[model samples]
Target: MLFLVLLGFPVFILCYMLAAPVFGYLGDRYNRKIILGAGIFFWSGVTLSSSFISELYYWIFFLSRGLVGIGTASYSTIAPTIIADLFEEGKRTTMLSVFYIFIPVGSGLGYVLAAGMAGLTGDWHWAFRVSYSLSPMGLSHSLWSFVWSSLGLTAMAFVTGALGMWVPLFLYRAQLAQGTVSPCLQETCNSSNSLIFGGITVGTGMLGVIAGAEAARRLRKINNKADPLICATSMFISALCLYVALMVILIAFGELFLSVNWAVVTDILLYVVTPRRQSTAIALQILVSHLLGDAGSPYLIGITKNDCSPQWSFRSMQYSFVVCAFVGVFGGAFFLLTSLYIEEDRKEAEQTSPSSLNTSSSSLKEAIFRV
Candidate 1:
């Protein structure tokens, strides 16, 4: 149970990582203001409620933390994209830098908020309650794209979500099948799969991000649609590696390919969609990714395993994981399709983005004055 408490941070991260993409998809398709506002509202409510949890229900604390991550994900994925639309080239980069400055400011303010609240109220729970009361959160302005989503990245999300949660367990089940490990009904089973997998995830995540970014940077000098091409290529290779992930090294390679597109996909949406719609496109991409990917993949895999064969756990999971390979292929194919339309879309975006922003900015004022 203490270990579970220790896992709170990791749980928050995994939830944030998984939820960010889903929220990204949402940002692109829905009312940006509502989603952003709802996320902040949800975050504050959950955090405040969590403070009321009793000592006996520690798991709820973890659950609340995870929910908070999901709520924050909306802002994380949507805010910058909206900023991208609001500013022109000369000021865009500067605005983004300024926006990120809030990270440190918020972090620092949080410590003060918590400390001050706890000291004044004489209880940690009041810290959360007071902090929630003080938060001012919401957004105004709304607009609405599908081209940015070939659902390829969502496929990657599915693959990673399932693998991240289940690979170690799958390996342990494999060992059990091979009779290399004993399964005790009432005793804790021993295994190093989790630790080993964690190391690989950390190492390959860094390497993949760097490799993808560098490759895309070099390739874009010649190809305007380089982002999707790189994404497609990586997904294809990742699919192949994960299809044969029975080998330990193949898992590492699969993760490497999967990690390469984190930033690249957002880049694609930024250029493909018009400025007024960029926020919606980016947020929707995130929504679809999490909606189809990490948010459900584990359960999908687990249920398939159970339904396939109750008695043969290892074989069932083995077959279920194969779904990820096919999804990866589908994801790669989506990226390929994205490559076809990206150039045209980007051209359209460049031509209209400025005018679109100008029109949108005047819309609310015009309506108000007309009233």
Candidate 2:
């Protein structure tokens, strides 16, 4: 059981990194919401089907998990893009942080649920049984047939997947046809005047600023002096603290917390950046954060565990996390201040660079020449 649990990390890394971007491409070319919804719906089905497996069905179980991986890949890629579409820059980081709080909490709960189920039955079989039995009826279709039935079911699955692909295309055409501008596009227009625009230059940061500004605006409408700057600052700080707490939980009980943490973190990162750049942002974040921040922390801990003591390994990692806590807090603060800085920089550039400003103005006029 311990080996199975330990093995899942590498498996997750393999499947997640490889499969997620492919689904993301489908989402980008089609429709983000549809892709996300289908991904969720399909993964839920896969989770449900896992309940009935025995050793005889172990291969089937692996295949089902692979399918689930693909589905989530689509969702993880698109969800962040959707959030970016909906929110602004300065607030994007905070909002993403808040959204990510679920990763740790849900993972904690999943373990509790698994343990409770196993304890109640005294057999692991019931865990899968309950999962499959409780899952929606649609997923059971594959189980009802045998030998010859596999071909028909495979064909059916293909048709369903293709249909799922089309839903996004229809939604994209509808949104664009209706002249509903994406929130990111709207921000590019209003950003010149917004304080949040001064912070980060990336599309993700832009979405955060727009979202934060809208939230601040709503608050101000209710209270005369509701300074968005102060509100954003506070939220980002609080979120950073929450993230640190989660990291402590993960490092302290690495065995149990890792899988769910991966799922949750991917979801949060996806939500922070824009839809168009979801795959790139997620991939980049994975590559960079793992490379720079915590990538080697686990290996370092394992070496200590073997060389010194198990307790020592965990203890050493905890000290490292102390530093991470500071980084998280500082990172949030940095995002808020950066957005304001970028907005100011753009304004200064427009004021100082007459030729460049003129070129931009002329291009804008040409694009909107009719208006």
Candidate 3:
């Protein structure tokens, strides 16, 4: 059971990685709405079908999850391009933030809904029925959500994938190191800590999104070139926060609270890419980031942990945290580099827009304000 549960996400992500580029290419040349709608319908049907399968059959369940991933790839790859096409610059940042706010919210809701349905029906399979029913409603709405969030998603995946994956165990070991061994030993204590962690993560996550958007909006008002600047600054701060959180465990929550804002910073960066190639660019970004970032973090961290001497078992995971901290810094530096090119690229994109040809001005002043 444990192995199957662990196997599910990576298989899903693997399928997602494989399918994203293909779907993204199609989305760029065809009707995105149709692609997105088909994706939702296919995934919903697959998930609904899964509920009928026996829980004892792990391989079939894994295959179903992979199909879900392929179905989702269609929606995830192209949705943000749609959003980018609908809005401009600062407004795009704000809209993207609003759309991404649902990620953590929906994640939290998934936990609650699953738990509630499991309790009511006394079987986990019934939970899929509820998800299948609700998913169709998402199909009815515009499929523009989350891909712009991919920038932040990549960064968070790097950091959280390395550190957050082991947080509970880290906490347990930390307590053992402090000679206070009972903290994680109690089921209630563990559950309470899990709840607190989830609550803080979701709450701070939404706040970060809102705060980052507003900060970007205000900075843009002061200077047209502030978008990437804001992202660079936020990512730098996030790196610092991760370092502090790792070094001083007592302040870990406070640091995590600050680090959540990095999501907003990275999200706005996606909008800075060329608009015509947005889907392809996004698909590439997704591919590289996940491939280089979270996909290997867990395995890397596990190897690091095993390489340590048995006497240093408690500290093995802390070494992984240090790697995550440095990665956060690298991500920040990448954003700073992006800041250097964004303004010029943005101007070039605006000039190439169909609306630009209809107007008479060669200056960006006219192009920037076009609807």
C-alpha local distance difference test of each model: 0.69, 0.41, 0.64
> Could you estimate the TM-score for every candidate?
0.65, 0.47, 0.79
Q: Give the TM-score of candidate 1.
A: 0.65
When summed lDDT is taken over every stretch of 10 residues in candidate 2, the lowest stretch is 138-147
Model 2 lDDT per residue over 1-371, tens place: 33443333334444655776576556556777877777777877777766666656556666666666666566656666666567654455455545544433333334344545666776555655565454333011111111112222122222212211221222222233345645345322222212111121122223333444444445545642233233324334433543454344321211122111222233233322333445555544433333333323333323322244434443543443343334434433433443343333334433444445678899899989867
- What's the best-to-worst order under lDDT? 1, 3, 2
For candidate 1, write residues 169-229 as lDDT tens digits.
7776777777766766211222256545666776666667667766776787898778888
lDDT at position 11, candidate 3: 84
| Candidate 3 ranges with C-alpha deviation above 4 Å | 51-55, 108-154, 176-192, 250-271, 304-312, 358-371
| 310-338: candidate 3 lDDT, tens digit per residue | 33665777776777667666665665665
Which scores higher on TM-score, 1 or 2? 1
- As a TM-score, model 2 comes out at 0.47
Residue pairs with backbone overlap in model 3 = none
Backbone clash tally (model 3): 0
Which predicted model would earn the best lDDT? 1
TM-score: the better of candidates 1 and 3 = 3
Return model 1's CA RMSD, one decimal: 9.8
Model 1, residue 325: what's the lDDT? Answer: 88
